[model samples]
Target: MVGGAILRKLEKRQAGGEDLTLVTRTSTELDLTDQTAVRSFMQSERPDQVILAAAKVGGIHANNSYPA
Candidate 1:
């Protein structure tokens, strides 16, 4: 959700004439657990910036259920 907000901000900035390449992915598209693909994409794309938005959830139950 927070990443979505930031992406919106980037879109607005790009719409204002800035050059930006917005690369986003859900769990289905790019699972962080796959280190090989992640490394390959990172090396190939070479983005100017990176955002690691994965963080702790609200409670222990949420974390325990989705042990990524």
Candidate 2:
């Protein structure tokens, strides 16, 4: 939901005639935890901005294993 909200804000900015380049990659296409792949992507695309909104949430059982 946060990611979608951010995308909507960016789209609004673009609609206002700002020169922006938007790029997106699915989980199948990119492994966000992979360092080498990320570095290569940055070198090639050379983007002005980047947003990382990756989230991994486990169920209640998993949450109970952690401390307060």
Candidate 3:
């Protein structure tokens, strides 16, 4: 999320109006834990760059429940 915000800021600095492609995905569309799907998406999209925002996020109760 932080990186995406930073990217947006950087893009605004450019004078030329460049096409912006935001590859935002909901958790339901792609699971970060699934490496294969991620790799495939990367290959197909072929984005010149990438901003990694997805994380293994959890709540306090969930973290306490699975202390791994």
- Which should have the higher lDDT, number 2 or number 3? 2
RMSD of each: 3.9, 2.8, 4.4
Q: Any runs in candidate 1 off by more than 4 Å, and if so which?
A: 55-68
Q: What residue runs in model 3 are displaced by over 4 Å at the alpha carbon? A: 1-18, 56-68
Each candidate's lDDT (Cα)? Answer: 0.83, 0.82, 0.73
- Winner on lDDT between 1 and 2 is 1
What is the lDDT for 67 in model 2? 37
The order by descending lDDT is 1, 2, 3
Q: Which stretches of candidate 2 lie over 4 Å from their true place?
A: 57-68
- Candidate 3 structure lDDT: 0.73
Score every model by TM-score.
Answer: 0.72, 0.74, 0.53
Best by TM-score: 2
Q: Write the number of the candidate with greater TM-score, choosing between 1 and 3.
A: 1
Q: Give the alpha carbon lDDT tens digit for every residue of 1-68 in model 3.
A: 56667767767854357677656676799777799998988888888877676656578888899878
The digit string of per-residue lDDT tens for model 2 on 1-68 reads: 67878888988998899887788887778888899998998888898889988766566777788634
lDDT of 2 at 46: 93
